[model samples]
Target: MVLKNLIRIRRSAARAEAEHPALAAAGLLPGLEALPNAILVLARERLAIAFANPAAEAMLGMSLRQLCQLGWTDLFPNADAPAGAIAALREEASGTTQLDAVLELPQREPLRVHAIIGSLDAAPGYVLLELVENEQKLRTDREERILDLSAVNKQLIRNLAHEIKNPLGGIRGAAQLLELELGANGGLREYTQVIIKESDRLQTLVDRLLEPHRHPHIARDLNIHEVCERVRAVMLAEFPRGLTIHRDFDVSVPDLRGDMEQLIQAVLNIARNAAQALRQPIAEGTACIEFRTRVARRVTIAKRPCKLALDLRIIDNGPGIPEEIRDRIFFPLVSGREDGSGLGLTLAQNFVQQHEGMIECESRPGHTEFRILLPLQC
Candidate 1:
């Protein structure tokens, strides 16, 4: 009877010590109770939730008590396990066992976890599970795929444009020669002249298509606002009479490294598009185009993080881009207006990308904004 009483006292003391906060502080209880990741603990005979972080609560959509009542096999069916054969092998192993597996929850999706089975200091038959989601890994894979596709598309455009350009120049030159020989009352000279003009126009389009590839970058330190101001002045001069152009500059934005001519051309393209959009509004005395600048930090472009970047927004309060072509507006030869060559936004995008930046457009019924995000020192 004395031996039995001593055994009971020792067991009670062990349980008390296991439940004490000192154990938690000492990191003996998995140290995951305060973490934000989903976790669970189980014993051999019956499963009890030893700890769960906030992330676990949010992920499994369950409370502490609710999860404790459920068994590992019940929460995750054996047939649906990620490492089916490995889990069975671990379960049948001799001493301490481990299984890297994924569990699919009823409310939530599949969760990747490393299940570790071993003896706690006092609890001999307990197991600890460290669950971590694979969502970020999957996201990274998707981003890599997108970048590969973008590169392939750009290469195809460059190759096709080069092939079409040489033949196009020959066609235009031949038409011009024919027109010169047919001069003086042949009247057929007019048709040759038309051919020459159309060919020249097509050749111009091809040149625009190849501009970004052919022009070598000439980068230097220059004030970004200076570039913006130059573009503004050009647009004002081109549409002097009725258009109202406003500058909302952030004076503190520092200088950027870029090719002056290319940056000017890129900004001019976007601003010119805005000016055209505002033509009817200008006639009605309600036309307004705003050039705004701001600083953005930790921006992600093309799946890469840029620490410090500059944002230039060209906003216009005119009839927005037509809804049908809005999605494909960045594609070469796709345009919203009848007379638009459809290469302005494309060229802008190409130049920005050359500077390791990105351009995006948002448009609604009455508002349209084209935002250019570029690295500050690149």
Candidate 2:
């Protein structure tokens, strides 16, 4: 009974120690590395990255070894002083401070992080910096907005398509009747033929607007390379003359579980969009498009933290997406080209969303890239 009591006391003590915050402050806790926020230890004088957690490494797109080789400025591509911030905190006696800052990395766009800079009570001149990316905080907001927009857009699309679908057949039949009444020799038949043909075109447009939402997502094991190859073949066949499609696929990326046909359509839509943008350049024999696939490490996609995701970029050297509709590119019925039905990207976004993925676009004059990120673990 005495031994049992002793064991029970030890277990209680263990739990107390585990709950202690001092271990984290002193850098003695292994659990610190497992947190979602990035942590870095910087020397007070040099403001250099002396130690980094796995999250920090992933956040900065640099290994700890690589980060330790350079000062904070050099490590975070386009960030200002990190250790200097910590040094300023040292003067406060508490040796801790919180600030919001933006950092630009080498491999990705800029990141806004909430930084907690502090020093261990036992370790002088050794600062512990805790960083939580705003991405995680903003993810839910972005996802909710996207979902709400998708729902509203879907309802609007269904209503509009159904509205157009009903009148389309009647319009075509009336045009046909008018054509028959006018007879073959009448010039007015040309006007009726135009009405029938345009009615068919409008019907086709309505069908495409409703297509992605209607189809049930048939999930299957999809080899990404096969999808890329299929898209490449289709694009090359269509724009065989002056366009070049380059492939930089990382074979290490594992197969993803998704609807093969839907995934194919999603990718093909983006690829074809890029190809179409290169219309003038393709004739100039200067058009180039690249299909680059790589693994995205430690990414949060669609509000879900994914240890790995597929990063597929369709890059084109054509004139960029026009600025007017760039923000509303994913919205239904928004189009840059006059002849464009504007449903291609909307359908593509819907298909990707069905697979728990997203399509992001970045464009400027002479360069346009549509990046698709899909979680591989799903």
Candidate 3:
């Protein structure tokens, strides 16, 4: 709809040009500056940029000043001849002429975009460039896959918990009997103690695994900041010395109906996971975590679209998530850490799902961000 309206505006500007030619030269498409899709108007004669839209600045991951300093070759230095791509763009002006290449950055990931160069109908030596990130579509598809796998994981976790529960009691009882029979024999009783201790630990883990299924959700009206504060206070208490939990919140956000405890657990689990990763850095006095919130509009979660939703981001600066297990991090038994049970994120995912929300993680060296989307009212 935005794209269509922008196109209509451009046509109107063109038609009004005969009466007001100055408007056509100076303000052909002033509104494109706010467009979501990245757009750049390049002066074909000088091979320099005339304008970079706000979306273009973000999509390119550079400031407007930085982008204006770059030419077609400077942006795509490795490409075979982006100039030819631009030359062909004007000839085949029916639609966007798609270019089959990626925009490489200095050290970051190569941004994938469908590049199309269009020519200005009124001007001969000016071309328009459009770039749309492919990651957005991939994310939408990933959400569906996550929901399907989450359903399967939920049943599997329940069945595994029940299976583990029965034998766990028998093992603990047998170990206790063995320990009692071994009475004063210190060496042998210690071994039995180990067995009993391990059994008890497993039992505790099994109980935790069944926790979400065991409790009935207690829903209530609450501000999300309350939840953030609750989590922030706990994190500060645990790692008070060097860790900083910054709050960047939208105070105008309205309260959403949710299970306060569940939401708190959900946020806590994610925040705690980040804290654990930041442990080494915290000791060196450089660890930081951000709890940022914003109002997300026209959002979709769990295959349901909400007019309003909360976009909560937990950003941390630490050695990024291990790439090997990143894709399956939310699975019940998957863990990036060797000693981790890997159920924190799984349970967090479950709690958010209970509120008809979704969580996604993006990680790279030195930067990791977890975005949670919960409906304002579901």
Candidate 4:
């Protein structure tokens, strides 16, 4: 009976550390100093609260003194063989590590988190464990909703464009015929000419709307860096003086299969927008644009993981996106600049969606990052 009791005590201590590793590490159990968040640190040997964030107090429902007074065994009554788990984790070499587990709080339900464990260089004989809630499930749900809406939006745009095309041609033809009937200098003929011009303009818009669908998929193995380089050259030539363009790429990333021309256009559209945004900075000769790429794994695009994804970030150092129009920046016909057509991003998004990808934007004063997430296949 005594052996069983000792075993239970050890198990309880282990459970305590697992629940509040931060407190155990900081040794905050004895004096509950108010901290910002509910974070607890645990030490390797004793499994006692070393430090606790204010958030931890709310989460555990215990005062610092109360926590310090209780032994690990007293806190966790039903923990089984907890000491063994700690021993196993400690045996591994010191480095950043992660584990997914359930943590029970006082009078509260068990919560799940991906616990990150690593040795702290600043503190000797101690480890740091940070809890990050597993948000993959929620991300998956959001991706699904966005993708479903994008697919539906694409189909509607395509159908609408097709329906408008035939009528548009007829209208242009009728106007042309009317113009020919009232040869030169006829006031009424000018109206027909105007009709033809407006029809042509609408036709251009419709063509752009249908372009992504009409273009045949031309997937070929190509280097993304090459694409970015080509875009950089073109933009530099177009905007020659006063703007500095920087390239930051992950050279290790292998070639991906995609339409080279479409990718170029998509990138160009974004780059052009950045260049335009830098008008003020360019005048002062301090405007800059950066093209950066990295590898992202298990990224969900359109509700499914393509397994591997490329993170292409277009950064600009200029006045950030205006707060009034930031949220609607991706919507069609929304433009922050007075002279902007607002169709650039719309077209870019359409092209990217065709390539089975997604785009996200983040902006703050003097900084903006547009991230394009594209899938790569082996």
Which candidate tops TM-score?
A: 3
lDDT winner, 2 or 3: 3
Q: Write the per-residue lDDT of candidate 2 for residues 1-378, one digit (tens) a residue.
A: 978944643443343235443443554435555566888866666766666666777777876557767877665654555545765766654567777777876677788888888876655656778988876566557666776788799889899899989889999999998888887666788889899999998988898988986878899888888999999999999988999999999999889999999988999999898888889999998999998999998887777888899999989999999998987888988888887878889999999998888887879989899888999863
Better of 1 and 3 by lDDT: 3
Using lDDT as the measure, the top candidate is 3
Off by over 4 Å in 2: 1-132, 136-140, 214-216
Better of 2 and 4 by lDDT: 2
What is the model-wide C-alpha lDDT for candidate 3?
0.82
Query: Which is superior by TM-score, 2 or 4?
Result: 2
Local lDDT at 136 for model 1 = 50
Checking candidate 3 for backbone clashes, the offending pairs are: none
Q: Give candidate 3 misplaced runs (Cα > 4 Å).
A: 1-70, 76-112, 115-131
- Distance (Å) between predicted and true CA of 287, model 2? 2.8
- Please give each candidate's TM-score: 0.61, 0.67, 0.74, 0.65
Is 1 or 4 the stronger prediction by lDDT?
4
58-140, model 4: which lDDT tens digit per residue?
55677545665664445554432443344455655456655665565457655555656665444444444455555565456
Candidate models: Cα lDDT each: 0.72, 0.80, 0.82, 0.73
Candidate 4 local lDDT, residue 161: 85
